[model samples]
Target: MQEYTQEQINQAESRGIEISTDVKEQLFEYANLIGEKEKVRALVRNLADAVSQADSEGVEDLLDDARMDIQELPDPTIGKLELRDYGYMEEDMVPLRKEAALDYHRMGSKIYRLGSAGSKGEYASKEMIQAHDGLFGMESQMWERIKDNNLDYAEENLGAFQEPMSVIEQEEALKLYDAGADIYLITNFSSPMYVTERMEIERGPEHYQMSMTELERFRNLEWEMQKYPQIQSLKEANLLLGTRRTFGIYQIRDD
Candidate 1:
């Protein structure tokens, strides 16, 4: 960044794009994080080096062995952040009880800096490994904060969730379903006479807790959520049935 003149930075800002000071500092942290990833990579290579020396048939070429060793790194958790994954924003997302939300956001921010667990590079390479390390470091720091707080921070910020599942809790039940008190049941009754009509009770496969009506409402809300461009990953989908069935099982598709 220092290589770019202040004028260039100003021009970049004027063009409606620029990394903020916060971002710049984060990038520096990213660089340090990636460096740690490299160290792990090098250690793995060294292990392979020792093995190659013992076995005559092992890795005929030292350089090739080292390169391949680094390329095929063991799987490690990495974070990936898309532009729209606003797990940290204030006004845009469903409320996630403040405590949990803040914890998640802080962790998310840490993960975001390292290209999210080096997920930025799909194909593993030296540079990719470093990027992965950077992300790992950032996430480590975030989780570390959680432990450091003794959970004092997390407990203080929790608030009622505004997601579809949370909304489902507010629905009304029409039958003596086995679902917990939280799940609400609502039927599109053409008349009061249809109340007794058999509706399959769906409380996730094993847990027969969510009434059919509650499930149906969740499915409807989920379908509406899909219209959002940012909700690409199912992870971001708000209407989840904990260990229950997929959201679709609740709906009766019309031909």
Candidate 2:
């Protein structure tokens, strides 16, 4: 009979799965009865089923079984590529998640720019001005470091801006996009009309106070900035400012 490592047993138990002596014996007997290739196929199928079903207990049970079988098998190798092919790895999802996050940030910056544009020479709430100052200061510091080819240090200071959207937010954003709502006006900025439209679509109001047309302008400028590599470089480094306020920083690529 094969013995499972303590870690394997603990992992199963942590997911509220019980691996009784009977289950252990059954696994060992099955392994002994099957060819190695058949055993690998069976285990892979079981793992896929567990993942598709979102069954944590089933996953833990299968992992424990695989660990025990691997200990006894002469050829106990599984390649990273194989695991990825089996949908057990999420390495490919990282870039998609980052892109989604950047899209969300761009929308927020559009709203902010739109609201600020209409208020030229008008007194902004002290609180709003203070928030802008804080953001501007941080961007300036980051730009200085980036200009010096010290992106590693600049990245370290960008923790606040790098926050990714939660799963719920991502789903909500997709739903709005699918419903024919403008991406720029989805959750980023707020105006009375935009707020009404957003609440109708999302069943809630976002606190941003920006207009849709101005946000459209912000989006246009952002796209235009990409045509000039030097301008793009300045924008990426947070050194570029809009006619009214600082154009928001571009997303940092992990290259």
Candidate 3:
């Protein structure tokens, strides 16, 4: 049986997850009993390398292999544990998140720099005009894709989920929309909701900070939210901007 290391135990404790030695032993025994194939084992090693390097493309390819291998296992407990506990799932997303953030900041900077010129029509050069337009277009498209890709990735990997909705949560979502922000519901990320609005809010930082605090509260209530009706009832139906398992983007509709 594969021995569980002290590091592994410490990591679990650090996460505040109780992964007892007995559980680890049971997982190792299960792996030995099932006799993991050499091919699957190799793929897992390659996946680890890919994740460590933050190679998003490599991780994507290996993730499918990992998922398939896990599904084929008699009991997928070990497979799930490896992905979640070892941080493969979270690591796999790092590259994409970094790329998106870089793009957002870079494009926003470009937009601000270009906009500072006297006027687009009068002072701006033709080349400057074209560059600004191009950046603007890319910025708009990126916002859409960021949310779409996040929702799709969560749905594909985690499976679909729809917790019971609450009036407070609904109100919070609407509040964001009213402020011209698009909300992206995230499950396994650092934040529960990712707002797609520009960082430069006219209302100032305090309002933005408050919105973030409300989102954190929204995330904390997820377990409690589950006790509400899981049904997609008409009254609960608002503008479902997009969805993934257990999380989705919503906006208020005009009557």
Using lDDT as the measure, which candidate wins?
2
TM-score of each: 0.18, 0.17, 0.18
Question: Model 1 segments beyond 4 Å from truth?
Answer: 1-33, 37-45, 53-140, 143-255
> Residue by residue across 1-255, what tens digits does model 3's lDDT show?
143333434444564445435544533443443334454345435544564566868866755554554454322333323323333332111111222223433322112211222222222222333344311111323334444444323543235423332223434554544533334432333333334443332211212223354344435444344455563432232222212124445576999
Better of 2 and 3 by TM-score: 3
Q: Candidate order by TM-score, highest to lowest?
A: 3, 1, 2
Model 2 C-alpha lDDT per residue in residues 44-153, reported as the tens digit of each score:
45654565577879978886776675443212333222323333333211111222223323333111111212222222222333344211111223223323433332
Locate the minimum summed-lDDT window of 10 residues in model 2: 109-118
Ranking by lDDT: 2, 3, 1
RMSD of each: 21.6, 21.9, 22.0
Per-residue lDDT tens digits for candidate 1, residues 168-211, read 22113323232222332232111111111112122111112233
After the best TM-score superposition of candidate 2, give how far the Cα of residue 135 lies from its true spot, in angstroms.
64
Error of 3 at 139 (Å): 57
The C-alpha lDDT values of all candidates are 0.32, 0.37, 0.36
lDDT comparing candidate 2 with the true structure: 0.37
lDDT accuracy of residue 55 in candidate 3: 80
